[model samples]
Target chain A: MSARPQVDPRGPRFAAWVTSAVLVAVLLTGWWPLLAAQVVVFAVGAFASLSAAPYSVLYRVLVAPRLGPTDEREDVAPLRFAQGVGFAFALVGTLGYAFGVPALGVVATAFALAAAFLNAAFGLCLGCETYLLLHRLPGSTRTVSDH
Target chain B: MTGALVALGTLLVAAVVGFALRARDGRVRAREDDTAARVPAEVRAALDAGARVTLVQLSTTFCAPCRQTRVLLSDLAARTDGLAHADVDLTDRPELAKALSVLRTPTTLAVDSRGVELLRVGGVPKRENLLAALAPHLPG
Candidate 1:
């Protein structure tokens, strides 16, 4: 109800695009390192700023400048929660590849890829939905906004 | 061989899921039409205020499409007599969000004057579809 904190809606989508590309590489090579890099990207976006969240820095400097700043800023918390969801998937996917679990790695990356692609292509946030599900979990603090 | 197949298969699966989510965007589905449990009166009353019908919007502060949902529903409320718009932020009110079974941002609940639930829209609702949803609820 208070004045909503604002962020460019493009930031997350830009980050998703990069995550999707890295995940595709992860699937093709089953390479733990690429997945590791992606896990770090998700962590940065989850807990920190876009400046550190891969490709978002480019968007902030180049794309945001050319866009001339329309009034499309969004609330920041959901985007951060969304990034956390991405991080969980990336972390699990990296572990699967690291442990030689080919099927598990592929499955995790595929699921994460679907989510990232949905955000990048359709502007739908799968992580936001995951955030909602977390709130529904029993007997915990029901607030996701505080975190 | 398996990696190539999974790579191809993964792309195909991604495409299918993407299309499906996009298909459901901004469309209203009346739960009444679907035979779900009736929306409780206290909940409906919280949303309804001196109107023939109320468009209750469930939103979170950071939801992008919720903004679009607010603008459209408020415009509909203005155009229709005895129809009012109510917006609730679920960020701090997750219990209400859970009780309402809201899975996505900008989820909307349509409640009639008698407090019977009419429709529930899961995402951003298109104007045309919203008008049609209201048609049956509108006064003769």
Candidate 2:
């Protein structure tokens, strides 16, 4: 079996950033339906992250085997962080819904969708990139490198 | 119904997002000119020896779909007789990627024993497709 290539971590990072931003926006906007939408989106993203390996396996069998080996530890950390943040955002949206925030969730959900769009469109992956960049900084670098 | 609608909407959004990304960044086109001659003489010999099926998967690291495909093919190879699956990583070999015209991760190719191409699948192939593809070659 040949070794797989290294894919840029940008995509997942961007996804994380989008998820975070959307959650924040929904909290402020008070759009219940939209907020609900964002929550589902975040969950799907989380699920995708969790079930990543199986999907990769499927790709290898059906598609081209030109894939690179990934740094799983590096990849999983951002995904977990995103998942946590997304869940929190969902909780907030639910509360806002109960309190009659009146479309605050919807607006926030739109923002999240926008963020997701940005990540996918521009390959911005800001969250992951930020983590990686910060991780490379002095103390963090040492910790990551050591591990 | 609401949940299903939400799921469909999300998929549509994802598709549009993916398409926009592709448009902005341009699709990664595999170069078809550089065929790797790295197939060892022994491997070629094995391929020539009535192996009948060559499963070539093109994949990249960090691609979730690629890994899933690999497991499926391995399982299939193990369960089936006389069908051989060779996973070729395209990351290190741009030449092979080009030669095979691989555009996306996890492109699978079904080849004959002599290395002649039979059918090609650009994404994760369904089990039914694989079974149907192999039916003609399977021992009756």
Candidate 3:
């Protein structure tokens, strides 16, 4: 009997690139404040994805080694969620900047940069941790650790 | 104006706090194992013939420490002479991780000029420690 080939289907690596392209498109639309916001948002998203090398390493070194084949599915949701948030932030920042709320966009960009630096230097994910804590509030049964 | 500035300041402060907390946790759980493993005969031979330093970094998804280690290793490789670094994402290749027997994120294996394994560092290695480890194998 012929052995079946193993197909690993986890989160898509091109998610960041797609989001970046969208942000660039929005920026090119010629909306002043929105374009500025998009810039900040895109910058944050890029840094977050690139700076997240530590978390990727941890998953490889600690989790994957122990979990085996099935663990691949476990990684998909979290990655997608993180990437989606990045896209959303960029979109919102663009909208805000377009509406003349550049400060909000700047804040978002700063937060993104800080998150990236933190993960790069110390191995921490403020967004993930915050998501977890929010999920733990009364009436919410889903824990951040579930991801 | 003040409100926006305050908000920005707050975000920066939160980032600093988050960074500090993670760093503290990282220091507490940092690994101390540093035994060099035997290199393959061919790899050793390549190193002895003046091959560049080979840096292998093992990492995982959702790991903060792994990211820091990658940056540090990349920076180290760039600054040092005849050093090259490659990172392996354990999430993408479970089999490779198994073959390498990686137990932690940020595990670094340094191969010297003789292609022999010179040192293995688990966790974030101090800049000085990494430099010192490579000093012996560097060409005089």
Full-model lDDT for every candidate = 0.75, 0.50, 0.49
Worst 10 residues of 2 chain B by lDDT: B24-33
- For B50-125, candidate 1 gives per-residue lDDT tens digits of 7878888887755767777788889988988878898876776666777777777778888877666788888888
TM-score for each predicted model, relative to the true structure: 0.85, 0.43, 0.36
Best-to-worst order by DockQ is: 1, 3, 2
Backbone clash total, candidate 3:
25
Candidate number with greatest lDDT: 1
lDDT string, candidate 2, A32-57, tens digits: 66556655655554554543433233
lDDT of 1 by residue, A38-71 (tens): 8888788777764577678878876778877666
Which model is ahead, 2 or 3, in terms of DockQ? 3
Residue A57, model 3: Cα distance from true site in angstroms: 27
Candidate 2, B-chain TM:
0.65
Instruction: Report the Cα lDDT for residue B54, model 3.
Output: 75
In model 1, state the lDDT of residue B24: 86
Q: Deviation in angstroms for A91 in model 2?
A: 29
Q: Give per-residue CA lDDT, model 3, range B43-106, as digits (tens).
A: 3433324346777665555343455576787898788777777665555444454455555555
lDDT of 3 by residue, A1-147 (tens): 114211122212322333333333433343445445444443343344522433343455555576557522222333433443454455555556667786665454444444444433333444443342333346442322233
DockQ of 2: 0.02
**What order do candidates take by lDDT, descending?**
1, 2, 3
Q: Candidate 1 DockQ score?
A: 0.50
